[model samples]
Target: MNTTPTIDVPVQVLSGPTVLIEYAGLRILTDPTFDEPGEYPVMPGYAMTKTSGSPLGTDEVGRIDAVLLSHDEHDDNLDRSGRAFLPRVPVVFTTISGAGRLGGNAKGLAFWDEATLTAPDGTVVTVTGLPARHGPEGSEPVSGDVVGFLLTAPGHPSVYVSGDNASLDYVQQIADRCAPIDTAILFIGGVRHKPMLDAQLVTIDNTQATWIARALQARRVIPAHFEGWAHFQGTREDLTRTFEEAGLADRLTYA
Candidate 1:
């Protein structure tokens, strides 16, 4: 269960990494993986199994102004169904390599680069790409390049979206550059695959999520990408318990 909106902005976690962040009348989506429970061969020997599907389909999630895809290499981030839905969005923001692969309405954002989106009434929203490490240090070659996102508008609370990032150092870096965040959408699952990087934390774990809140000095926190897949080792209860034990439960919310 979630308490009332702390920032008054609607942040909904649909499933997996898929989230709808409505800011200043602009709808922004993150890592759209809408496929039903199934199996995907991530590596030759490693397979990912989705235990549940999204409650809302693409049609139901109407009017997305942009998609902040962390990366396109992983199935958990962008599945078949999600790939098909990208064209409908006005713009899809992702890594440079992903933009070339996705093409058509997909624009790439390098680290610290800013992209803008306009609403029907000409309200502008700024989206900035942030550095994201998918696994332990020096794991980029195997983990591939991932990116987090930061959104800002004139009066709306700033939102930081951590996309499959595992490093607290990177979070600290973001804090130094853009601290006092109003809302943070953390992707935390403690995901692990024995075949990859000696099985390290692929994303922020429950405890780490709490640290992220502190690092960013965030007023409100919403978690995503923590469940619905076999590789996810953390549970919602674990996340809630972690925050509660840390005396930060008032900052946690679910949609």
Candidate 2:
């Protein structure tokens, strides 16, 4: 086990909305979507297409201590391969309703709820659930429940993982609650389903992402979920340009 506290935490962006976070001697995976490019049925008439494959396979991830699932209802976030990978993991933290549906080894967390886990080196790490809205106001009933995450440990930089959220108001709330976030793994795809929610982004766009970084005062911002999906409206290039124009390019972790 690596007991040394890292000043710069390592984050690996596997694919859309999937990121592997290494902090405080713990290996945490966020929204594991390992399946290859294909179409996934969301509802009777609605389906989401994955246009790319994950950079790493499940076997390559080694040992994942916990899975931070923002929401389970969306296939783009948790596909067939991702679902299969869950049981192998020791624990999964997700929305309250998602936990109930997932059952075994899955624990539901309401907004602001915190869960403590011991790291490989016996260091204590706390993960707190944060608010998230998948779509416009009053869209929760149809869009399903979603939640972000905040990770904290003594003598370590705090980490924030934004789920599929679009509301800047929610970001403000998170900032007010947990400001000065050291690192932020943001989900930014600018997803738009015309029939479902006209012109409304399911996740934060480039502009909103920039605001989120400023609001949280994040030292390092790792962008994900901004590519490899059919519904996504924004791209990495756009995000880079947006941040650069805003004079925040220095804070981005393009790697």
Candidate 3:
């Protein structure tokens, strides 16, 4: 039996890359993709297809204080419908380029940069932008700039949100800077696009996720971005087996 305890904060995986996190008096979201199952043309000969949409969309999940967008370029992270939902939010934190492209309440953050959000009851949450590599090293030009986020407060558990990072070196950088992450929301799919990256893994696989859990010594790890798209290959069972084999099953939670 899985003996992992409950996560201090409330986290609900809406499907794919989207997640809802309730911290203290704050409501935060990540990479909202609300589009139904369909094929979207990203480039002339390239397309991404969604297999299914989440049961709950933006309207159902009310009162979002902020959105931690990994990147706005990809349809999987911010689909056409999700783009429409941005204006309704109070603040959006994303990469510098993404913020420039998406103005109006969207704030740009570089690696190691920080943003602040105040809760209703005089609580403050600090959001830090961290580095993320979508594919192999030096693939930014093709993959575009992606970002991760770290949420921290005076007395709250530290939470790390790994966007679409594939490189453990970058993750190690994060662990070195801030260890003992209380909660981690990892976007692992092990997705591969042969034409795009020549069949190279574009996202963290199950083994990498387990390594992250151990490296950060995370109490709870709620996974996302592992399904809903045809390109996604990592499954929950695969991740469970990997974590169990690594002796870190207790840290894995499907919250």
Candidate 4:
């Protein structure tokens, strides 16, 4: 058996846009929304369906190390059941607004703040917060501060987890200022109300993910948040096609 202590990351699609990331022998849950199954129309009224994607039963997941929640939307991220499991875990990293929403049990951290946490084998895992946006175009005052994360293992290539982003500008900026990224786990679904709107409806979609992969020149790209929700419309097929069409099929991998 290969006994190298490397970060082998895997993305498990729970339900619309909700992803479970397994890395470094630890589980990281993102936007854990176990909404009642069915189709729900997007408030502000964009799409059809009250909800979709079967709810990942409480016992469905295992070993949740940390949570990289972007916002405090119940539909997109964080459900009642998910929150109940928070206090059981040692650390829960999320946005300030979400911290409040997560109640006093979970500690809050700012975007770009790097915190070191212990892994299963006592390995020091460095978690760095990366900036993210809810919607595309300009930032609205109403939305909360949503951010991604950069995890660096001692003997492994660094991994970047994009929570929910609509723009590649922030990704490019992160790639430029910080150290080089080896594997980037992007939330790709391109779930939008219209073709011309932003993609953070759940993920950055195909076009933006492509832009980021090229900009950062990352080695491996894992797509998430594409095939889980009722509101989410983008698919892994869409991302694959876009990357292939863009001549980036080899670089972008679907997890």
* lDDT score, candidate 1, position 244: 99
lDDT of 2 at 149: 93
**What's the TM-score of each model vs. the native?**
0.96, 0.95, 0.95, 0.82
- The C-alpha lDDT values of all candidates are 0.89, 0.89, 0.89, 0.68
Candidate 1 residue-wise lDDT, 1-255, digit = tens: 121235568989999999999888888899999999999997787799999999999889988988999999999999999999999998999988889999999999888999898877777888999989999999999988889999887766788999999989999889999988888999999887788889888888898988889888888999999888988985788889999999899999897
Q: Write the per-residue lDDT of candidate 4 for residues 1-255, one digit (tens) a residue.
A: 011224446666676546677666778777666656554444554544534554466577766777766666545566566667677666778877778867765556677788877778877878888888866656545344677888776765677778777766777778786545677778766656553343335357678787888776677787766665555665666767888998988877655
Which ranges in model 1 have alpha carbons more than 4 Å from their true place? 1-6
Worst 10 residues of 1 by lDDT: 1-10
For residues 1-255, write the lDDT of model 2, one tens digit per residue: 111234888888998989999988999999999999988877789888889998799989899999999999988899888999999999999999999999998999899999998998888999999999999998898789999998898778888899999889999999997888888899988788877877688888888888989998888999988888898885678889999999999899964
Name the runs in model 3 displaced over 4 angstroms. Answer: 1-7
What TM-score quantifies how close candidate 2 is to the native fold? 0.95
Clashes of each: 0, 0, 0, 12
| RMSD of each predicted structure | 3.0, 2.8, 3.1, 4.0
Tell me which of candidates 3 and 4 scores higher on lDDT.
Answer: 3
- Weakest lDDT window of 10 consecutive positions for candidate 2: 1-10
TM-score of 1: 0.96
